[model samples]
Target: MWIKKFTIRGILVGLVCVFFLSPVCMAELPITSSFGWRVHPITGAWKFHSGLDLGYDYGTPIPAMFDGVVVQAGDFGDGYGNQVMLYHPAMDCYTRYAHMSGVIVDVGASVAQGEIIGYVGATGNATGPHLHLEWIVKGEDGGYVYADPIGLWM
Candidate 1:
């Protein structure tokens, strides 16, 4: 029912907090790496970095940035390690948290903003403990596009 109301207008205004994260959690964390093109930390070649890496202590709790359904959870062996992908219909977008120590939410579960979905870890290709966050929206061609998530989360 909620997906039926989707529109480009929704995506434009979606950053307005249809749901809110815990006030004290993310604002204090430092950004270890930003999104976009850069030299790979693990690899020697240049590649596009799809998400923002938030530096944190190992096993730190990770919260959902918006109210959404957990469309995916667990390690898919795709190099993301233990991850959680949430679909936020209100924003006409999805948010992904990767390289997690553990995933607490399961696929299809509805999560509120600020819900602790997982814990931080140096999983997958990561060199150290951090939370890799991605903001993805649909493109005009109806394909998924990884947008810079810093504007929405911070």
Candidate 2:
């Protein structure tokens, strides 16, 4: 009887561990394609700009990084143009896609990883067409802190 009770308690503990760890293990963003280019006519410099720049003439599709709720979506007016901000509870992180031509998701909407959320564009303070992608960690005072999106992938 003692051995059986010990085994049952171990099993329960294992199950609880799985439940809590699953979400952290499951956050990721898919890369469709990436390209490095010389700064456009707007910004004349061949600085080492990293990150995959998905190019489309118009009406290109952009996807979400992970399964999360849209905490904010609108024209932020900070050179981001029409942007979408997603909060991933599982990852305990947030993603910001900026300079978008259009936004497909709404605030409070649940989106799966790699799901279409917006299209690329030159808006806000952008000189050319591109998405200023950023990964953010939760900060104190209900604010978000920025992280290098390229570094996150690396």
Candidate 3:
């Protein structure tokens, strides 16, 4: 399928960008939880966490990990709270910023790497103020998958 092909190309492009581009400029927020299957903090049930929970004071600015255009910006009541999703055409991947007190970017707006896109907050199934960051990639089956982001911004 076309989606599969595009995803494959995206993976290659992402590798090249990772090697040739400047280091990712992420905020130095403390990671409270990492990506993977784990016990849910709220429900106490086993679940797969799709992102990193970066703990910080309320209203702390959250930065974009790569140059991208905002594709979605708003609350959908999906347990992500006020969120921003960016599509990095160069890498053919998407990054998500969630649980924000505020979103500064609008849909379709271009954001540079490290630009402040939102603020941290305890929204949507959160216990405290933090930013839930997710790196999303398209799988070979043309479905989306979560990528561990510990190495990308650490």
Candidate 4:
């Protein structure tokens, strides 16, 4: 009887740890592809990937990693379909969410961290459904530089 009680307690503790310690609880975004140089899946040409790809099921709600205002939210009509761009004033940076099937926010809307702003999908020059996330910071030359979203944000 003592062994059974111990096992049950251990299982319960493990469940609590997993529930509270998981990414879902940690507010971490799910990433499918990383940023950097890689051979394109369709083009097969080596190039610098400007963003990290986070995937969810088709039409899954995408959360914002930080509080920001929506600057651009719509289709690029080419490489980035149904995208949402947010400008973070505190960070002095811009975050882009590309290749979305659907977007829920509009320009000038304020979004809180972990708030749903769009849905995941394979739009634009993508092979499957995923959120192409990009971090943009001001360059020394006044232009914007793209960075990997992995570890940098979530």
Candidate 5:
């Protein structure tokens, strides 16, 4: 009797968690470049595409793909140039907008989904004006696992 009861209860709980706790993310805009291993445009060598590049004109506004707090926003001076990283607490995931010409949001700023946070630009190690997006899953060691945002879809 105990085993049967626990099995049924466990299944029910698992289903509920899947419905309420995990949410699938959708594409926020048109894609210019997809994610995955591809021949690099600049280097002409096979490399893992870390983010989704959205096509937009120079200075085109880029909206937040989901609700989150702005964790970092500024000229990274890294290869990404001006970027914005948003932390979604509910999902424990981060979304980075890279190669932007300018950022409107600041660190600790709360932004709703679809809110414009920055404009597209070819800053840093970029070829042209486009928003390079990256989705990062928070890891246990206080680090992050870069993921394909398209895989977040339901």
Candidate 6:
């Protein structure tokens, strides 16, 4: 009977540890910065703003959100202007940065988290100088879906 109780207690303790550690393992964004806020700039009115606007002076350096290979980097010409797409296999995610004044990384290049990848600016459809960052999870059908950037930061 004592051995049975000890085994049950061990299992309970293991379950508790797994429950607490799962989130930490899945949570992304190991770095913190003075980015992200709730404000609407596109509509010129207060709306549920998504993503972060890393406001720095024009030509301020922008960094990679994670270690990834630069899959696309150039003028997309569809209101994204100078854009870059990084593919992170570990996270199974892709990060896009739009409206860059200059793109520093080239296609097929590997970049580390927090490494400068470009410069923020008012390009394409932007009304002011800022970076429009987006995180996307690739769907099974080769389509990409948007994910909340704040969730990654948490």
Q: Number of clashes in every candidate structure? A: 0, 2, 0, 0, 0, 0
1 or 6, greater by lDDT: 1
TM-score head-to-head 1 vs 3, winner: 1
| Model 5: residue 120 alpha-carbon error in angstroms | 1.1
Q: What ranking emerges by TM-score with the best candidate at the front?
A: 1, 3, 4, 5, 6, 2
Candidate 2 lDDT at 69 equals: 98
Which digits, one per residue and each the tens of the lDDT, describe model 5 over residues 2-119? 0000001121232123322443234444577877778988889997788878777899877876779999999867789999999989778778999999999989999987788988
Best by lDDT: 1
Candidate 3 off by > 4 Å: 1-29
Model 5 TM-score (2 dp): 0.72
RMSD of 2: 13.9
- Backbone clashes in candidate 1 total 0
After the best TM-score superposition of candidate 5, give how far the Cα of residue 95 lies from its true spot, in angstroms. 0.2
Model 4 CA lDDT for position 4: 8
Whole-model lDDT, model 6:
0.63
TM, every model: 0.80, 0.61, 0.78, 0.75, 0.72, 0.64
Where is model 2 more than 4 Å wrong at Cα? Answer: 1-57, 139-143
The whole-model lDDT of each prediction reads 0.77, 0.59, 0.76, 0.71, 0.73, 0.63
**Lowest summed lDDT over 10 consecutive residues: which window, candidate 2?**
1-10
Give the per-residue lDDT digits (tens) of candidate 4, residues 1-154.
Answer: 0000000112123212332244342144466666787898879999777887766679877777578999999986768888999998986878888898889998999998777898889988899998787778766566667755554423
Candidate 5 local distance difference test against the native: 0.73
Clashes of 4: 0
Tell me the tens digit of each residue's lDDT in model 2 across 110-131. 9987788988887775666666
lDDT string for model 6 (120-145, tens) is: 88888676787777667655455666
Q: Pairs clashing in candidate 1? A: none
lDDT of 3: 0.76
lDDT tens per residue, model 1, 1-154: 0111112332322223322332333465478988887899999679778888988899988888778999999998888999999999986789889999999999999998778899999889898999898878786677777777665543
